[model samples]
Target: MSERSERIIKHSNTFLLPDLGEGLTEAEIVRWLVKVGDVVAVDTPIAEVETAKSIVELPSPYAGVIEELHGEPGTTVPVGSPLLTVADPAGAAYRAEERAGSGNVLVGYGTVESTGSGRRRKPRVSGVSGVSENVSVARVPLVISPLVRRLARDGGVDLHELTGSGPDGLIVRRDVEHAIAFRAQPASEVRPSEVRPSAIQPSAVPATAGQPAVAGVEARTGLHELRRTPMSGFRKAVVATLTRSRAEIPEATTWVDVDATALVELRASLRTATDPGPGLLALMARFVVAGLLKYPELNGYVDTGREELVQYDGVNLGLAAQTGRGLVAPAIGNAHTLTTRGLDAEIRRLTASARDGRLTQQELTFGTFTLNNYGSFGVDGSAAIINHPQVAILGVGRIIDRPWVVDGEIAVRKLTQLSLVFDHRVCDGGTAAAFLRFVADAFENPATAFADL
Candidate 1:
């Protein structure tokens, strides 16, 4: 051992998880990059975590040998929980010191001060009565003991409205029992004005809120075991986004079937054995870019807080890729200025990166409009959900052979379906129809469309 290691008494230092932004509360640990015995530098990436927004690699703040890893892979960890322990020979002062943002590791992140003991302790609860000595009045109910907190939770007591009877306004078990008993009284015994509004209502409490499972119901249904999966991480985020979209936006869908024989032939004529020119999705994306330029209302997001339609001068085209994690939409910035081949390259790159979980925050979150080519799954058509707060999304279905009219005669031709889902707040049905028709006309007559390009 080195001279500095010989002087240290024990390893009491620990590193806590930092706050990842965007209103996220917890993250799932995807994997750990370092093992327990590995030495790490101040900026070494130690673990990869999957947040609601994206996958992020967390860096170490202290230079030391790793002592312990707290959570296992695939486990969801809260924001302030211990990530790992590090033993440094620099003594207690260095271990207790906090690491503020250095503009590189993470913005608005800092280390939590260690309590100078090897054993972990319960984090101090703020906004409590006796706990906050600097403040004159407590803003929330205060209970220091875990037993008292559990009593309030299990009894369905609203601690926020309760006035503590203990010294310095500390809440005790007696106060919780009183609230629980008061709620149990008959309705005729309680007056309207005497009833206090609880932060947690009895009916709103969860089935597993410090309570046992409903035993008889499962037995009656003949169910022996229940497999439960928590609604969290990326899946939960996607649900929240779609829920908000449905609740807020007045959306409408318009679709059209087109004879794409000309568009298919155009690609075939441009390709050699070695070079495939541009893909069908890329050609469709180029046309969509042109359509958005004509119908700018479709290429923007709603500023709900300002109650304004914030349209952009350029398009950030998002391509939705299905990965193991879920469907992720990564956008190409300023896509309007790119050529057909450039769009093809970007779409491929983003699709690969998204599938590998290597997409950056900016790529995943900056789309003004989205394009989902669900035809890769060999489907004909779908009414896709609009990726909010963007006003519109365009989907391309599988191209197949079909009978169509040409020169007033029926003939076999290549055909495809196009669908557009748009926010009615931005444009009327006429505008959305016109935009969809523009793309459909381009697909039917690519030579005419390429002349403009």
Candidate 2:
């Protein structure tokens, strides 16, 4: 549990959404597990809500008969807003100081005081096989995360067929995603195989005023025809952070092209059948860490309230990864202490977790600087946006073979472009340029650059 907020547990019949710490402000209700008049025990999962970082099952802090639910599915509820009302006939569980359990099960929030243990009911079984109308014969699969269940349910993927990749045969989000990708088919193609001939008959759908005329695709002019998806809490959080960064930080950009033939050859020589050695990005990250240590001015953020620039002795390297939800930059804490191999392992782990939408709040916060490998998207360059609070972000473009002048002779060399965007208030162009030059030089001559380390 995080120690950011110190508010007491709700002693009244109404239970507000608890503070999901790490500066998270709100969550979107994915679905409610309990309805009005349902009896619930303390710590019983009442709803599945999605915060900016991940989906969470919100446990009930009060155990009683549920009287009313405050919000519906798909509604956004701010932190500290009322979630539901419970009617305590005995009036014992609603006391602020004598609440059962520590209420410390949730990812971020904690209780003011707790006694007695909480009760939890067993999860109800649901059908996961697509081939069956009845699931009484199917075995219960081990699934823990509500997000994973939601993904599997939405994509029509059969969870029984998948082998869990997580601990103790726990089916994770990525397992379902892999199944969905492998089993995905067009509706027309899938219907013939999965549905009976009698069930395949097309039913007449009413032609609504703003609905599309064609079955496959249509362009309707009416305003009602426009598809509008509500902005999610994740997207909202991103918008708020980027908006704040743009409004508060004075930013500048600097870039340089480097001939990275030596670095490329160096990585290739280090690779063998048993071990692939450190990844190219890991080598670059090593260079970035070294560069930051050499120029500490570009490694920290400016404190607006204190009118001071807080520079840290260590680095938390943020790697920008594109996930199904959105762009997330999960940081590697104390990256300055890690070797290229260590960075490689952490990068791979974080990248996989980021894509699967399983990163924790701690992993997603407190990034000091960011490294974006937009090169994987097949782009040459980007004057990237500065991640809020952090002063700079470095983007590496696609590494490709290009003509270069080597000892006054034209030669083909592996070349790439590096773009650095930093806060202008934190450092002048000369400082930013020098930092960029240091990284570029490292890329050009890995042996010399690494020797200094």
Candidate 3:
């Protein structure tokens, strides 16, 4: 077929809303960044779309003047529905010729033709979309992925001048570190301090002569018109999840003190011998998993709808990581099967991914249990709420030297408090207490607990 014939047959380019989560078929258009007659380039952010998973920015695929915006903000469009149309009649024909010759299309620049009008018959309208014009908007120009952009915004890092080191010179976590390191260097070797004139004193003007007669008090206008922008996709998702968890789960908490001296000593000894030893957090995670194996009821979920306590055979431990956008719980799959070193490696990887906003849907979902390490923040204790459906969450406190009784004598020992929160509907107070006790015991004598398991 002639290239001109392909061009003539090609119709308008249809931009569809991609699936944002586990087959999430629809999403609400949060806002449009461009208007009709505005020129858009491929990969330029055209609109903000909110899905059940998160709020995401949709980029344009075809470079042209925006022909039309198919839906307004707050309207939910199906996954394959036309979000907007770009004037790309000639580009469409070129795509067909390339596809026929090479059997492959260019990335992020090709168009997917629609079968019909590609508009949903019924659009959903639940939440408000769009930003107020009064808000102070800052334009950040950074060559980074959407995930990296989200991460940088949350971390309060300026991305304008940072050099990227990823594929195609894209910005990544390491690039951020490099920027921080570069800025931390001293400006010069011998910097002179500014010396102020201590002896010189200025003559004060007489109160009556220096003060000019005040005219009628001038009125000043204040920034009284406040504008509130709707939450971003990620922020909205976090709120929805936390709200659902609080509403559906009947959570209860219990706290216990553990002598963590043994665990600490073990970690120090192991680090001296091993090149890269298991960190304290990883060692504790292993002990926690072992404890879960002994107390299987704690490694289960409460299905309130069906009135069933669903016990999981595999243990996937979710680590609650604080990210720039919000809290994210990314799972270490089959944590029970991993050794102390293995668990540590996986936990580090997962947490880094969570902070970078690179976690997959599966990693963020289906966690059998959760671990919140408040100790990282030097907290002694906190009662964390159980993540919805999951029966239990474990919180770790900071370890400190304290007075304790040993052989009927006062002695100094390293102690840390452990908090266990569970769904009261699925497990009782006694079970929660016993489970924490078991964890404490395993940490005190990890060799005995992990010897055969």
User: Which numbered prediction scores highest in TM-score against the true structure?
Assistant: 1
Off by over 4 Å in 3: 1-11, 23-229, 272-274
Clashes by residue pair, model 3: 55-233
Q: Report each candidate's C-alpha RMSD, comma-separated, in the order given.
A: 14.0, 13.3, 15.6
Better of 2 and 3 by TM-score: 2
RMSD of 1: 14.0
lDDT of 2: 0.76
Q: Per-residue lDDT for 322-371 in model 3, tens only?
A: 87657778889999888888999998898787676567778888688999
lDDT of 1 at 75: 68
Per-residue error for 443 in candidate 1, Å, reads: 0.9
Give each model's clash number: 0, 0, 1
TM-score of each: 0.69, 0.64, 0.60
Model 2, which residues run further than 4 Å from truth?
1-15, 31-47, 60-72, 81-225
**lDDT per prediction?**
0.75, 0.76, 0.67
Question: Tens digits of per-residue lDDT for model 1 on 1-453?
Answer: 334334443554687888987778889988889865467888899999999878899999877767566765666889999888776646434433322231111111112323457332223344332343332222445554455666776776656667766545656666676567556544445532244434212322223444543432233334423333566498888998899999999999999998999999988887999898888888889999999999999998888899898889999999988998889899999999999999999988998888788888789889999999998999999989988788899998898999998999999999889999999999999999999999999999988998987
Task: Report the Cα lDDT for residue 3, model 3.
Answer: 49
